[model samples]
Target: MRRMDTKTTTEKTGETGDNAESPEGAGSAGADIAAKTTEPVEAAEAAPAVEPLDADALGPADEVDKDDDEDDDEALFPDEAPASASAGIGGAAAAVVSAALGVVALTGTWTGKVVAERETLIGQIKTSGSGTPAQQISEIYADAWHSVALVNGVLSLVALLVAVLVLALPGRPSWVRAVAVAGAVLGGLGLLLSVGTYFDLFLNLPTAGS
Candidate 1:
């Protein structure tokens, strides 16, 4: 019985030793597999990254995009050209009419002055004359001069109003604006002068008999 026990114990020890050696061999194999898997991953990570595309090098696509943008701008601006020209013409016409009316006002003012001066001179001559033909002629001319002054004053006032309306209008050109401003100034002055002359002529009219 003792000898059988010894042989069994030796056989068990030999089996345990083989089991330990098998575990070591398995561990070495597992480490080699892990190392191989990690090497490929590290190599991929270490490689240089791909460069992004440059905007300047987008050759045909960028040019096509720029051409489309230019076409859009042309569509927006150039198509409405005629309407802008028409507006400019209208603005110029209004300024011209206002300037012409200013000239008319200035002319009426000058005419009023001439009539007023003649009436005054005639009145003086009539006072100096006594039951003479010249006195009769002076009386008739004085009435005509007074009538002329009234008409001239009304005409000048109309011109002044027209000029003011033109100035109030929109989109005037540079030259047109200059002319309108000049018209306004001259028309205003002439309006005041003519109004005063008309009033004076009426007040200083010769008595009906003279």
Candidate 2:
């Protein structure tokens, strides 16, 4: 039989037996083992938590902010920002300007109008064979020239209006400048002819004895 006796060499106050130790020392040893294991585990968790910087807004954070699921969802859906209406307004203005330019190209300049007149003439030829070929061609030119003249007159007035309205608009358009140029030249040429006709320079000359 094995037994712990009171007078044994391992049980006396001056000895420290293998299986018998003071309560305070045992508690201290256990606490040390727990602390060592816990510390290393915590350190291991901390080491790999640091993430490199990336462009992904939904990616993980730095080591210091190692909160897992809570913050990731919050970061992904940030606060709502206001939309810039001015951007839309600017884009719309550009579109309006492009459309106005297209109109001018079709109807504003002499060359543009001449081209359109040619198209209309071709259409007329197709629809109604109303006259001889030479007459049809002559009527086409006549109609086109008259339209050019009237357009010039209207554009002259519009040019003056544009100068006045330039400061009033939200912004200047590319078409406005081009229209102004065409309007000014045609208007000036007509004005000069009107002045000459008024001063009798373009009047009919009298026959020798009539």
Measured by TM-score, the strongest candidate is 1
Q: Write the per-residue lDDT of candidate 2 for residues 67-113, one digit (tens) a residue.
A: 75547856787673335455444544444444343345234576637
Top candidate when judged by lDDT against the true structure: 1
RMSD of 1: 11.5
Q: What is the lDDT of residue 77 in candidate 1?
A: 93
| Segments of candidate 1 deviating more than 4 angstroms | 1-81, 109-139, 201-210
Relative to the true structure, candidate 2 reaches a TM of 0.25
lDDT of 2: 0.52
> What TM-score should be assigned to candidate 1?
0.43
Clashing pairs in 2: none
Q: Name the 10 consecutive residues with the lowest summed lDDT in model 1.
A: 201-210
